[model samples]
Target: MSLKYAPKYRVFLFLIFCIIKACDVLFIAYMIKLMLNLASSGSKDVTELIKLATIAGIGQLFFTCSNFFYEHLKMTIIKNVNLVLKNANLNYLVAQAKNDTKSGLSLMTNDLKQIETGRVTAQLDMCYQSILFIGAISFAFINSWQMTVIFIVASIAPALVQILTSRLITRKAKVWANANADYTQHVSDSLNGAEAAKLYNVQPTIISRAVNSAQRMEEALRSMNFTQAWALEVIYTVAELFCFIIPCTIGGVLMMHGQLKVGTLVLMVDLAMNFITPVVTIFQEFNQVKSTDPMWKKTLRALNYSKNPHEKAIDQRDDFIDLKIDNLAYKTNKTNTEIFKDVNFSVTPGKKTLLMAPSGWGKTTLLKLMMGSKSPSKGQILINDQNLTNDWSKLHNYFSYVNQKPFMFDDTLRFNITLGRKVSDQKLRQVIHEAGLDELVKEKGLDSPIGENGNQLSGGQIQRVEIARALLSHRPILLADEATSALDPHLSLEIHETLLKNPNIAVIEVAHKISPAEKAMFDQIIHLNQTPTD
Candidate 1:
């Protein structure tokens, strides 16, 4: 998945950098051997030594420059890959039947970080280390194949250690990822309920709950970190003990028998360290990369999500048509408890319909069903006498929803209304005027920033902003679920008037309580007394 998102040219540059880095190391090692041999000679050549030192200095400088670009390119690719994955996952979550907000948040933060560090960076490091190891071992073999073979066979000990412990490390990482997500959810809940906690004087209880979650998350993280560290340490100890002792012992014996020169023996030892170290690093990097498989798999699912089978390519319609709900029913999947049954409703252009039901009734749920966020157990929603499938893609062009507590982005008032669309100023002002937002625009210019969730605006003003947004979309049908429930009677009446005065759009609002004056504003008031079927 990361490869799918990374730019191919950048990856190619990364490989080129790795090769340059390895060549630099080998060139410097060879230079050291030449200079040492010159110093030990009975009659040293001063000019040859100067040339060797100068070449090694040039190689080191080149390596430094390559290292800088290598790090930069590696991080750039990781950042781009993570951003794409996050956006894809967000879209997938929005398209899901039910929002799993906790998991979504977790995926964006902890899981993505894990994947970036473990899979992406580890993969890049493994490639570089493997290349370095190959170059170093080939150089060592050219110097002395017997010692090189001994070191190669001994390097297997560390690889075996990594293979044995890889599974446990992966399991620990998954546990930590889950615990981190739960902790994030707990923190979000605590912050969102801050006002309620203060009103109820239960801040201590909230703190205690958050602390418990944090402790569990930390424990899991500690276990995961410790397991990974232990495996690497064991691999390191084994690789060093075998690669160093066995090779050095054999090289010393060969030099004593006049089969190898002291200069070449020293060069082989230096090269042997390079070869053995990369072998250990490669195994360690591979283990770390394997630990992120769980997160990578989750990301793949999001990127590979398929469009709804019933989805249509149509985006907008130029005409309005009647919407009908016939014999509608719904039930909970877990409890198998019926919410409502045998419900019926209809709305046509220029109509203002009020669906009045008790507080415990499924009024909000019904609105969700109409908005295509929720599906009914048995029924059909029709537009222009055609079946309306429970898919947002099929419904968004025709229906605009106004929630009781509508969401607001922290941006300029214009963005909150047009949502980054290229709407004309004249048309925006018209919708603003129609939604009773003339005073707001005049007071705080069109570009005035609205704080997070519209905290800068009053409840009535926020409701009006949502109305303004819906009106601007030109969607013919507005399904408002208790849109004015939080406002005072006067404000509620004002909002209802703004909603119902538009003859070009139809309004179907659901609520439990309404002032008679407000109720009179609607063209039709329907009472819902739905019950479960046997």
Candidate 2:
């Protein structure tokens, strides 16, 4: 949604303040003109000068208060708009493609920040400058229409300069934004792979790659800045020649010819300066707004993103969920390369199913499909006899997913396990025992900080924490994708037995290797291949 009309009353008040501010400028010009006339006429009376000074002082006071209120309103509007954009971008990101996620991140962080810092000020300035320019020019015309015409005509040069350079400024700004996104993505990737880089002794290589990305981003930023600076310099130079030099020269000639009074000449110069100030400011603000057009377009696009129109909401009734995959197929959206086809499976309530596949097979993909993170290219995923193709939002209500590398926040162990959900101490202890986390709890207590992404915990401990969370959720279906891959053999077997033995819940686990004893515990074993089968 456009924020053009946000905080309507405040915007109206700001416009009124702009008008008051313009009036203040005109009053000051009039007072200066009166003072000049008194001095030129050699009048001994100081009453008019005192009266003009008093009026100008009152105008200055009003101007200051109006300016303060205007700034306050502008900030409030900017804050509201920022909040709206943040919420819209977050909602869109949740449903966006993985490849596009980074772009959304950039928009929410850097792009929004730019709008806050630059665009908000530019918007307010544009409004104020336009009003001030009009008021100042009107007064100048009242003084001498002939000189006002010449002044305005000369000002066109600067406007033309801005118009010509605006496109290049916008183009450079877009390139910089894209480059910055790439740099952000690369930094995120490097940080996520820090452990791998360290273990492989490739820190130097990673650093080099990050430096190169930063350099590219820096170059783009420098280019954008240089372009903006050049445009401003050229425009300002042309504006100075017309707004100051030409007007003063013509006004002086008129004054010498006695067609214009010295007081009137002074007033015209002051008013013309006021008019020129806003005109120059308007051009600068226009360039600034134009430069941010790319970011604004990106933000708008993200906000406009809509899910598949054909997608329907699922019924949210509390019932046991039995999933069925009928001839499921999937392919890469970019390459159109089929990962798998004709995949068939069923996850019945109160039963354990094991999915086995070799490396390069679509094991995780299949699990994601079940969880509704991915959609099947062909066939249907039925949940409790209802098609789940487009109703992925409801999947969370029925299932708990335990990924291979479960993410943990930088919070206490208890917070990570409960995820801010209230749970009884008895139930929490029970799940911790079942998930083999009792020892860790006893050793460090539930209040121990887990560090970022559970870095404080070992791999087995992280997996166990994930299982405990899943168990605590009490969802009917538990989906585990290589959940025990990081655990030792004995711990892996214990976790597997714990999940499979839970008679009240349905479990579907994917693993490349499982012992025969573990395999026998499952009600069915499905192997994913070119044609998946049970």
Candidate 3:
């Protein structure tokens, strides 16, 4: 498949490539002179030979510099293309589904590496070899076009071999890349499920699964290598045989028949040796491309922008509005199962409310829907009675949804707390203290590093940090999904009391159980009980 690298960069790359090719002619001619001089008789002038060698050396230097420039530019093109695809202009389709972090991680690390460091680009380097082959042929024709016939005979063979090899390699690469992603996912799943694996005594099963997966991936890669090797063997056999016999035969015939000078005869031999250089190099490059293409296609396809579901509203509305939900319903695609159907709920202004639901019922889905993640399979949600779907831009302004699992970046804790919002240091400290994280933050400092996903922090501390973030932001509506589940009963009660005291704010907590005191703080309890049909 054709990679749609950024057009501007592609055009610039093509232009530079043209320049590189044009420069090749000068280098080829100079090389031909050097060949002829080396092939000359003992009577030939050494000073003249030295001059030709100097010219050839200069040409070689120019060629190397041009190649270096091409490599750099290609890297720039790849980077720009990848970035443009990653950061959406406005992707609607992607936002409708829940973020699959595992898949995203696989795409970023495993799949991306396959493409960037793999085969197709290797093949692109073969273009230079192709150019070299053409140059060698042109030079050979200068002394003996008859020898150039070798190119015509050998050309189709290489292409045919590459075509068949590429198809097999393509299939193998797909399997290999899939296995790579799967293996990465398995490691992620296993490590993430380490607690469960230990609890269930399934470490053996995990190890077996991991081993089998690695073996399959290894087998696929080996198969690809074998296919490439077979094709290369054919080319090498042809090259060695032709290079040994043809040039000498043609040059000898021309010399004996008095049709060519002795210097030209020697030049033909030298050119024949030089001729294989490009073909060999191009074949190597082609093989690299063969390996890289599948990975490239797979990764870039994943990067394709899936537009946000509420892109239009996000674009159109920007003002803050009160959080509200009307008739709301949702289902999962995997099972076509109703997560919650024909549901209706609300968190009106100036009233702190709690959403109580059984485990796995759809509290998180509902929160995401209200946040204008553009989810919920059916019904309408609103902000201040204004349809949230219709005005998703104001949803974030109106409500802060602190998920059960907080996403901490590799950056600072301070950055995560502020989240680029303009809150003062004192205000940040006050919220942290309110959320009961003042002690932790004091020890580490806000700028102290939090490892990936805050693996360094305890479950309780992470919860408090996220709560601190939501509190510091000061949104009118707070949507907390099992937010206090990580915290101890005492801390959860403190949080409940804090919300109760803030009468002007509205809160929606999706808790498995709220304490009697916490229960008293909430003005209303919205329950999602199983219906007859449910």
lDDT, each prediction = 0.85, 0.82, 0.66
Model 1 spans with C-alpha error above 4 angstroms: 40-43, 97-99, 306-317, 530-534
390-420 in candidate 2: lDDT tens per residue?
3567665577888778888899999989998
Q: Ten residues in a row with the worst lDDT in model 1? A: 312-321
**Preferred candidate (lDDT higher): 1 or 3:** 1
Per-candidate TM equals: 0.93, 0.88, 0.80
Q: Which numbered prediction scores highest in TM-score against the true structure?
A: 1
Give the per-residue lDDT of model 1 (tens digit) for 82-114.
Answer: 788888888787777455668888888888888
**Against the true structure, what is every candidate's RMSD?**
2.4, 3.5, 4.6
Q: After superposing candidate 2 on the true structure, give the runs of residues whose Cα lies further than 4 Å from its correct spot.
A: 1-6, 97-105, 194-202, 306-317, 331-338, 394-397, 412-415, 418-448, 468-474, 528-534
Reference-based TM-score, model 1:
0.93
- Write candidate 3's Cα lDDT for 1-534 as tens digits: 223555665645755674586456536654665556465645467777777778777878887778777777666656665565444311322443446655566666765555555543443444445655666667677656765565445444545555566666667767777777677777777778878889999999987887787787778778877877777787666665555465567657777898876666555555655566566556655666667665556445545645445444232134434555666777776787777776676566667777877777777777777776646777887665666573455566667666667887677788777877787778987888777887888789888888888877877777777777777766677777887776788877876676556654578877767788888888888777554223
Decide which is better by lDDT, 1 or 2: 1
| Candidate No. with top lDDT | 1
Give the per-residue Cα lDDT of candidate 1 at 7. 85
